[model samples]
Target: MKGIHQSSMAVRSFVVMACVVIILAGIKTASPIVVPFVLSAFLAVICNPVITLMCRYKLPKWLAIILLMGFIVLMSLWLTSLVGSSINEFSKQMPVYRAQLVEQFAWILDKLQQFNIHISRQKVLEYFDPGMALSMTTNMLSGVGNVMANLFLIILTIVFMLLESNDLSKKAHLALDDPEMRLKQIDRFLQSVNQYMMIKTLVSIATAIIVGIGLSIIGVDYALLWAVIAFLFNYIPNIGSIIAAIPAVLLAFVQFGPAAAGVTAGLYLGTNMVMGNVIEPKFMGRGLGLSTLVVFLSLIFWGWLLGSVGMLLSVPLTMVVKIGLESSQSGMWLAILLADNVDDKLSDSSMENHKQDDTEQISEQEK
Candidate 1:
């Protein structure tokens, strides 16, 4: 009977894993539709606070949502225009930078030859491949088009989500056996996500503002453009800053030489160090933190699943998953494994307390 029970448990585990795999596969396959809705849901969460505040002032739900949605659309459109103009200006300037690039590469090759290393300018140019920038530009433009196309759908989703938010608790109460517990769990999860998003957004904005100021002072071309990119990519973890820095650094190098590039790098590094390493940890702590490996894996997985936008949303989406897992009995261990491990000390103390309680109970029963 014990063996049979073990076999049954094994089969259940297999079934659970299989279902997860199937669901993930479906999500990936349907990403064009799924990604937008998922993004809208997250946006709705971020915007819900504002909606609640407006409603508190006796604003109707419909008016509050309309105002919020209009604000979002206008901001998005303005940002899109800014990004578009930056790209256009960049394209116009690239040819002028090409000569500078060639000269810099030639000088580098000459220096390398001093160390008994030699490479042809043609080879270097081929490797650097100016044409690749144009390709990248095209791809970026295509991505923007996709975003514009989905703007309507995303807004619509947010509208519906906000409308449904009021009834969500009521629906949960009707659907669940333990409505109070479930509602509490959900409230906890939403609170965690909301706090994370709000903090992250503020940090990103502050970072971007600093970066923009630094870039403007440094006379970098498209300062606002790079700053905006930095803000967006800051949502991603680990390598996001590096990716965000690449184009700005490269442009700095081409336009102002290696010294300017170094300064730009320093600014990015310093800002990220202070904000990301210091300030962020004090607020986020272990409760919201994921393991470094988990963060990287989510970046890769979600980026693959939904492209660049997926990469941007990766950490938050993974956090939602982690929070969900942490709320479950059987999934708690897995969630702990993925966590940043800052909470382990607390868990250890709790375990010790449990053991002490068990010991006391045993002694009392024996007496």
Candidate 2:
């Protein structure tokens, strides 16, 4: 009977994974409309606590929401303006960028021809396209018509999220007749989402600042652009830091050749090692604790589902799903998603009590 139950569980797991794959496949078709709303919902989840705190200060509900929403809108506008100016500068210099790219690729093409390789450069371009990779963020800037729509959708979605957040909890309770179960799931989901967002944002900020300073010192072109890229990609676990290094390294090489490139790579690598390895772990304290393989796989899965934003949000999204699954009878699924032998950190209160006991014991021993 135990073996049969295990088999059933395995089947269920396979089915769930398969469904996720199918849903992601469909996202490519529906992403224009879907991405914004999904992004907004996640934003709202993370912001809900802040909104609630405002109410504690006796602010009117509508006023609090408006205040929060206004801040978001202004911030978004500023970000967009920065991006637009950077893009304009980039546009003016596209000829230089393009000429350099061709020069770089030509070196590879020359080496291939010297070896009597039958592969043409065009063939290589066709097979292993760089457009998607080169863009890094999205296909929007590549003369694609969707950039405006995407920007608009994201803004509208954020507004909707801010507006609907107050009613969200009540709606969830109403949706699920079992108030206790609904609340439990909602609580777990919110906790995981909030923790993920809070920690990830801090990590991103740290990476951006460090990378920006390093790049600016090294005289890399558009240091802020690279910093923005680093900040955005910092959301992706494990592999993202490496991916963010590429553009910087490229720019460094184009500007100051191989030595500068080496330093650029080293700086980014050192920043990631210190933060991802040392600092983030201290604050995270084994929460989430997703396996290395699961982290990479989730990156691919979510990236496919939602593009660059998906890759950024992948871990939190997975954490939310894992918490939701675990909140019911499927705690094992959460166990499966996380690292084996992950130590659950004791709460501060518990740790403080233990420290007090230790002090008392030490005093008695001295006596």
- Highest TM-score against the true fold, candidate: 1
Backbone clash pairs for candidate 1 read none
lDDT of 2: 0.70
- Give the lDDT of residue 36 in candidate 2: 67
Top lDDT: which candidate number?
Answer: 1
After TM-score superposition, the amount by which residue 367's alpha carbon in candidate 2 deviates from its true location, in angstroms, is 54
All candidates' TM-scores?
Answer: 0.84, 0.70
lDDT of each residue in 18-81, candidate 2, tens digit only: 9977976787788866766677677776677777899999998778777887787686567566
lDDT of 1 by residue, 338-366 (tens): 77774773575367568769988999999
lDDT, candidates in the order shown = 0.79, 0.70
Query: What is the overall TM-score of model 1 with all chains considered together?
Result: 0.84
**Backbone clashes counted, model 2:** 0
Residue 210's lDDT in candidate 1: 97
Local error of candidate 2 at 292, Å?
Answer: 1.9
Which regions of candidate 2 fall more than 4 Å away from where they truly are?
1-29, 53-58, 94-133, 137-178, 181-186, 328-367
